[model samples]
Target chain A: MKILVCIKQVPDMESRFKANSQGVWFEETDLAFRMNEYDEYAVEQAVQLKEQLGDAPEVTVLSIGPDRVVEAIKKALAMGCDRGVHVQDPAAATRDPWQIASIIASHAGDKGYDLILTGMQSQDRGSAQVGVTVAEELGYACATTLVGFAFSDGTVTAKRELEGGIKGVVRLRTPALVTCQLGLNVPRYPTLPNIMKAKKKEIQTIAVAELLKEEPLATTVSFHPPARKGGGIVLEGDVGVLVDQLLGILKDKTAVLR
Target chain B: MKALLIGEYRQGKLLDSTFELFGFAAQLGGETAFLLVGDETRLPACDGPLYLAEAAECGEYNPDLHKQLILQAVARENPDFIVFVHSSYGWDLAPRVAARLKAAQVSEVIGLTDGGFEVGCCNAKMRRTVKPSTARAVLTIQAGAFPARQPNGTPRIQRLAATGNGGLEFVGYEPAEAKDVDLTRAEVIVSAGRGVGKKENVPVIAALARALGGELGASRPVVDAGWIEHSHQVGTTGQTVSPRLYVACGISGAIQHLAGMKKSDFIVAINKDKDAPIGEIADVLVVADVMQFVPALTARLQR
Candidate 1:
């Protein structure tokens, strides 16, 4: 089995963000980058499957971004993926989900991947569209927000998350795609030996222009900080007084006490 | 413009969020049609034509068959926009439909403006106004962002058949585990976050919740760390709650967490870091340590 796990490099959520001059995306300067938290689960699932299958499956991790994205791809490599593919796109931040999905499908379409895995959504765009869109583009059977997964006899059985904590069990034959959700698995930390091994692993680079076949279907009119909804009074001084002040405000304003 | 609103049906009834889609369609200002993939009993009352797919044929959900029914609806209605409430069903189906139609797609739209639709970008730290360049677009409206609007007048119902099926099959549905605490019904929620230190400290916050006559709520991390049950989680993937009074103890509000509880009538965030995003929407920012302050607050409340 050939497994392809798609990952994305997102700016650290803790970083201070500012819109670029064009007002389309956040500024890159002074920002630290890391693999999207959700994608970590995807990588871990793929590696675990490879281990279970006992070398029958070859796992390749793919990511699309500028040079910094190589770091993310390498992290997946350190997690036990066989190789990495970086589709270098400097303007990746500006591309909408449709364009990004199209690019990924274009590259992975002819690769004969038996299964594809991706995070439920990217942290930056939060579009949650790419995995399903890629599956549609490739005409692969797809499922999303999966928390449990098992494969046997060319059939994949996945436990997907539904609204209000319901779980739906879905089954699909190989040549399928599934999106990993949070709490799916605990991702392994890269050991020092694996880190050194990942440094030597091959990272095949492809230019985004070569893979992209469609124009952006959507445009960002503007991007800016969200407006505050008011009411941010800070209670100060001693902890005792602060608790007293908070209780007083809650009693006066809310019916919780009553 | 012609619009098609897809309604979600579960547990033998249409979800209330279906009405929220009606609310958005009214705002879009055009002829609106409703689509639900279920039997006649699952149909929602709407002013426009309603398309009902046979539930016996579709089962719980076959993504391919449902997508085909939606395509048939689009072909018959010629809708310029297809709308779905941003839920699990929409999250999985809308993108497939959009890709097939070659339409522009946007997810998690929080608001509509004269310029275009507003969605959160950069992890909800910023908002982006997006305009679809294509004539057709698929959109998923954010849950709770739009109010529920009941459409007036009778609706013409159209029956749809399952014409096609991709290889994907629905096996079954596992009901959620029995939950002892329903956060939705709680008037007051004292939620803990990673800042509470560890699992041992969760009882401190629970004590505070008891003092306030409320239930204990928790962020995703706390739940993921096994500090509490998943039923008590408050977030996009966990639960969307709007309690009367929400006390976020040591919770730095992530966007998903905010989406779940931001609608609370009164929010008070207690975090040692005063700059936490929770403070932005909080009515009061109680800057203090979660360990020390929660006990004191519980003591004061009990007295």
Candidate 2:
């Protein structure tokens, strides 16, 4: 079984992010970078699948970003991917998920990998579009928000999370794509020996112009922090007094209205 | 502006958010028609023209079949905008539809504005007003954000079977191991966060919920910590609720949690940190320790 897992290197969400002067994206110089949280689950899932299959099923990790993204690829390789494909371009930052999906599809289309996996969304963009778009472009079946995944009998049985607390079991054709959601699995830290081997792991870098030969679909106008929300009226003095105040309001305001 | 509103039905009934999308489509103005694919025998009455399709394989929502169904409907309706109520289904299918039609796509729009739309970016830290490059678009709306319109008029229903080759099978739905707690119908919810401190302290919070005769909810942290079931979790990946009153205890509201419960009619946030994002929308911001405040509040309510 051949599997392709797509990963993205994003600014650590915990870091204080400030938009650049143009307000188009974050000021990269000050922030730390890591694999998007959900993508780590995707990478972990791929490794676990390889271990479970045990007949030497290969897992290939793919990512597209600026030159710095190779570090994320190396981490995936350290974790256990056979090789890495880096679609490197300094300008890829400005491309929306539509364009990003196009680039991924260009590489993934002919590969005919049995299964393709990606994070539900990028930490920076959070559009949750690229994987589905890539699946659509390649004309493969797909399911998103996949919390449960197992491969058997030439088909993938997946548990998809739905609104409310419902979980649907979807069986897709073998050549399918599923987006990894949080809590799907715990990502393992790469061992020191694997980390050493990751140094020699081949990373094939492709230019963005070489993959996607089209104008960007959406142009960014600016990047800025959203309007700060403050001015919340806080009840002060005593906890008991605040409780009294809340009870009075709930009895008068909400209890009757509903 | 002709807008095609994609309607959703679950468990033999039309979802309320379907009407919410209709309301949003109405606000977008122009000819707003409704589209339904798969077994929609219990289809809600629609105000505008209805393009309805029924296919046997559409039971549990396979993205491949849904994409084909939506594309077939788009070919028939050919509206300027395709609207979806942001759900697991919307997140999966909308982008694919946008690709098929080359429509500019926007997901989770809180409001439609002039020139573009106002979207929550930077993890709800900032709202960006964006203008799409194309006039036509595929849109997935935040559930419960728009008011649902009452359906009225001579319902013109067009029965069209969406293209499905029956290659995929929806093997039915499996309810999570925990008893399913439907948060959407919860009129009042007592939600806790990491600030509840520890696993043992959750009962003290649940006491408030039981006292108030409301359901118990939790932020992602509580559920993720295995302190509570995922059935109680509220957020983008969890359940979206619009209870009449929401008591957020020890919850410094993250934008993701806000997405699930911001629509509640009244929100009371009790976090020690008054600067928490939850306070921004909280009607009553109580700057008190939840450990102290919640017990007192629960005692009073129980009294």
Candidate 3:
């Protein structure tokens, strides 16, 4: 089985985000980029699945971004993927889900991989729609929020998380798509030797135009920061008095009889 | 324009988030129609018409079957927008339906507007360039993000007969249960993260929760460490919560963790690091040792 794991580079979650003067987007100069936190889980899942398959399965890491995204490709390589394919696009930072999904679907179609793994949503875009959109485009069976998986004899069984403490396990045939949820597995930290080995791993760069026949469907209008939260009112008094004050405030704000 | 509210009904009743979607649809300005796919049962006191597609063989959620039913319903009604709750089932069904209908989908939406809906991006802090496309949109509202209102008086309920090519069949079903506590609806939550040291110290936070009549929660690390169940995890990867009060003990408030519970009514963070993101958002930021502070706070609460 050939498995393609799609990864993305995202701004570090800890960094402070600031939009540019034109309000188009965040300034990327100072932001440190890394493999998306959720994608790490997806990559880990792919690596584990390959290990379970006992040397028969070939795992490939595929990413689409600017040249800087090679760092993320290297990270995936250190995680034990057999090869890396980077689709270089300068405008990747501005591409929306439809465009990104189109690029991925086209690449996956040509690669003819049996299974494609993606994070349920990218940490940066968080659209959570790419896997499904790519599935729709390629006409493949897709599953999301998958916490557990098992594969045997060209069949994949996945346990997906549902709302309200419910879970559903479904079985799918080969040539399917699955999005990895966090807590699926702990991603391994690359050892110094592995990092050194990853530096020499072959990374093949392809152009987005060569990957996809379609143009991007969407464009950004503008970006703005979310509204600032109002200053909180601190109630000063004893616990009982504070509880009363809090209840009164809640009643006033929500107008609930309780 | 009329809008269709696609609801996932289990055991003959609509989910709470479905009602919240109805509340949202009413705000979107239209005669809201609800489509329920399940066993043959009429929904009582709905705001608008309820179309019942009963397929006993459609046991578990089959995306193909749902897409066909939803498209047929859409063709019949031709509503401008289709709304669903951003639940697992909705995640499975919405995109397929949207693709079949060629409508734009906006997932994880927190609010709506006159011109378009305000979608919640997963990496809201990062990729600031990509904006939601505003065509006829398929939207899934985040659970608990929108307030549900019970409009006065019973709504008109019109039931439609089940009609479609039902080609999907369920072989069997097995449900997986997580031992973790579900913290999404907890009224009060006390969570600990990696900073809490060993698994032995987790009970300290639990004691604090007990004293305050609240439930114990954890970050992904504590849960992954096997100290607590995945259900008690209050982070993006775990459960999204909006409790009355959330007390974070020893958590640094990673954005992934904050995305799950940042909307709580009152946040109290107790961390050794004064500059932790949790401290920035807390109503009361206590820069004390969690090992020292948790037990002391629990004792005071018990008194």
The candidate maximizing DockQ is 1
Q: Candidate 3 local accuracy as lDDT?
A: 0.73
DockQ of each: 0.67, 0.43, 0.31
Interface RMSD of 3: 6.9
TM for candidate 1 is 0.93
lDDT of 2 at B99: 90
lDDT of 3 by residue, A60-169 (tens): 89899889999999999998888899999987876767778888888887778899999988765676888888888888777788877788887778877665435667
Assess each prediction's global lDDT (C-alpha) against the native.
0.89, 0.80, 0.73
Model 1 chain A weakest lDDT span, ten residues long:
A223-232
Candidate 2 structure quality by residue, lDDT tens digits, B37-110 = 64546665666678776645465365566667677777877788898977887888898889988777887777
- Model 2 shows how many backbone clashes? 4
Give the alpha carbon lDDT tens digit for every residue of B118-163 in model 1.
9986656678899999999999999878889988767899888886
What is candidate 1's DockQ?
A: 0.67
- Report how large a share of the reference interface contacts model 1 reproduces: 0.84
Would you estimate the TM-scores of all the predictions?
A: 0.93, 0.84, 0.82
Q: Write the per-residue lDDT of candidate 1 for residues A1-258, one digit (tens) a residue.
A: 999999999988657778889987888999999999899999999999998898789999999989999999999999999999999998898899999999999998899999999999988889999999999999899999998999888899999988777899989998999999888888999999999999999999999989998999999988877888775788977998898798789879988886
Chain A TM-score of model 3 versus the true structure?
0.87
DockQ of 3: 0.31
Per-chain TM-score of chain A in candidate 2 equals: 0.88
lDDT of 1 at A237: 75
Clashing pairs in 3: A126-B122, B180-B231, B181-B231
